[model samples]
Target: MPLAGGAVALVVTLTLWLSNMSRVPYEDALPTVGAVLALVGLAVLALRLVAGGWARAGLMSGVAAVYILYLPVAVFAVSPSAWMRGGLLLMGGVAAVLAARRIPREAPGVLAVNRKINLILVPIVIGIAGVVLLRQIDLERHRPAPDQAFAAFDGEASATSPDVWHLIFDRYGNNATLGGAYGYDNSAFLSALRKRGFAVNEEAFSNYQRTGHSVASTLNASYLDRLSSSAQAADWVPIYRSLTSSQALRFFERQGYETVFAGSWWNPTRRSGLADRNINYRAVPELGRLVLGQSAIGFALAQTGLAYGDGRGDQCRRATYKFEQLRELADEGSRKYVFAHFLVPHPPFVLNADGSCRSLAKATASSRRDNYVAQIEYANREALRLIDAILAGPRPAVIVLHSDEGPWPEPFVGDERFLGRDPVAVDWAGLNARQLAEKMGILMAIRHVDGAPAPAPASPINVYPQIINAYFSGKGVEPAPRHYVFESDAALYRFKDVTRELN
Candidate 1:
């Protein structure tokens, strides 16, 4: 019984680990599997102590049968509905229990039968896990490097350099998109930015519809079309490498600028080894936190209102802390390149406009539009405050305020829920203009100490190059031409020149 239970736990762990290896670490699965095995073992032992030999053996067999069937049942189920999957699992469990009852309680060979079952299943499960681990190792070895797509800037540094602040507000929409879609006028935020000398790009759009691709493209100063052919969208290693070890950071490092990173709870931008300094609230490893949040126990606790399994309040506190840290950094007397990624105006909307924690139920139960707009109002006010402090700092600075993507549309309020859906199964043909706009429209503005406002209708990929040309002209690098490209979130590697389509 113990061996069978252990085998079940092993198989489930390996399956989940293999599926999410790109985003989750191998170590995170170990604890979850251990807990499952311990619980099942305890339950089997308790049954053995109280029940007759025949009944105990039958229950053990039934459990083993259910676990064995779970893999195929879960794999073959095509529906996204959780209830459907649960119903299928329950039916399988019922069938297994009934079949176990046919075995005699007094059978002389019952022990032998159970032993043979465990002997057969244990090796198979272990072998499967070993194979999966080997394949994952190979995938890690062959992952692409960021330097392949971007060359190091070979330009001489200017004698005088301004502090550069690149602040990303995840999923923030532009004024027109906000007004048209949510009827929320964003003029106050834009006017505030302009008052602080920011040239708000009213027509700016993200180069990619997702954060990983968008940030990767902008930071590398290149479109991902070339790399997409050779890269796998399912594997996030290449994308993360692009964000952390990009040519952009190396370029700034070469120019005698100290690199400071302020990251959110998201793994990719949470912290970087390349940064000279890091600011983050959560000390827990991101993969571990993610694993715990998605575990069965965590789900149960969340549903029962016993815990904030999603950690929305923690994220809110982290956002507040990050903003405060950025404010402190503005006073430092060094030429620094600050990259702060804030999860604001993004869901698990827990912050009111005044920065106080809102009830998690209110945040979740409210219409997606209402929660998003309120968060946006909060983000806008906080952002202006941060910008004002940075502008009043010791040195002249260049601040680029932007979003990796725009507010998600109906049926997709948060990126987590949106990305969880199978991309291939989505109906791309039915995607309308508003949906596309929601995915593409983003916020972008630049405040340079001594430069004209950036041209309207800017692409994020070109923003840094223009900055380089204006401030570090010795590099002699031409600015990337402004062009709009749209790629389906389903086919992440595919790119379409949608400049004309949107126009």
Candidate 2:
């Protein structure tokens, strides 16, 4: 009976995990599943040791009855959400399950016969359910190896190295896109970068639309086509998995640099296994919240606003914390390679130019534009302040001020659902040339040590290769052609090269 309960538990939890595989990896929930199984196994073993013959069978039957009634009822009852509410329903279910055992003796012959049949039927029902749920998982499609993805970027470690900082300002558009698409002039910011010994790529774009794929391509020193082709088409698990570790981090580690990762509230970036130190703030990990939302009790609790970890205020605070932390780390005198992905000026329009928080009044294009401008205005001041500090440090540094991807096009600027919506679900053909550039054009600025040549036609994809050749002297590799691939949101893996159309 306990063994039957174990199978039911596995089926329930794994079904939830598989349903949300886009955010949570399959291996993460395995530990919890394993613990449940272990506990059930121990309970059966102890019962066998303590009880003999019919006594053991009766005890096991009771244990099975309680578990059989408990888990599903506890998880799925009383649709509304709260910890107190879910807990009460769970206790009520247990009381009823225990009470039902006694009332069966008082009932008629039909009730006794039905009870016996149910005892036999429950295990078979659970077995069939487990088989049906297991079919959802596809084990053949695995993630690509980082080493193979970064083959062209192979290099031997150099004895002398400068502090490298790859600062990704989320959704910070290039000057061209800012002026042409958003009706905002960003020449002042670009001019400031130029004055600080930085080369701002006048024309730069990301091959992918999403942040996960863009960062993966840049750090792994290959495009998503190279990376995504290795993985199963339309499977986003590989893209998110690349965030935790990358060949870029490994290369710096090999060169005896202490790796530091400061990420946004996104789950994959919150902590990295390969980094020496992680600058994760008080923001809750998204993976935990995602898995919880899949469960019955958790789903009820979520409706009361307890399940969501996101608030516009958190977006403001976390970005501030990251900026402060990055500035502090710059002067720490360690040979550090910091990759800080800050989610600011991206959405929700929560920040003002003077560092004060503001809420959006309405979902209008004008209102969104005003709010977005204010947020980016704040980001600019912060970026300049950070750049000054990094430049003023005792040791020379190489700072790459890049954006993962450009902002949403004019069509989504006023939509509140923009952030939560699956980005690739849109009609790829709907985006105009200007809108396409607005979404894909990014800010790529590099400040190299002692005049390391800037990448020609310096797109984000070309940054690492140029850095390797100039700083690490890895190989004589030509700059990757300025080819861009646009994939339909509906068919994620299908690539359509639109370099000519954009150019």
Every candidate's CA RMSD:
6.8, 6.3
lDDT values, one for every candidate: 0.69, 0.66
- Which runs of model 1 end up more than 4 angstroms from their true locations? 1-13, 22-129, 137-142, 283-286, 294-310, 411-430, 451-457, 474-490
Please report how far candidate 2 places residue 235 from its true position, in Å. 0.6
Model 2 ranges with Cα > 4 A deviation: 1-13, 27-137, 157-159, 228-230, 283-285, 293-310, 360-366, 412-419, 422-424, 450-457
Q: Which 10-residue window of candidate 2 scores lowest in summed lDDT?
A: 50-59
Candidate 2 structure lDDT: 0.66
Tens-place lDDT per residue, model 1, 19-47, is 76776544434565566667666766665
Per-model TM-score on C-alpha atoms: 0.74, 0.75
Candidate 1 TM-score over all chains jointly: 0.74
Residue 419 C-alpha lDDT in model 2: 35
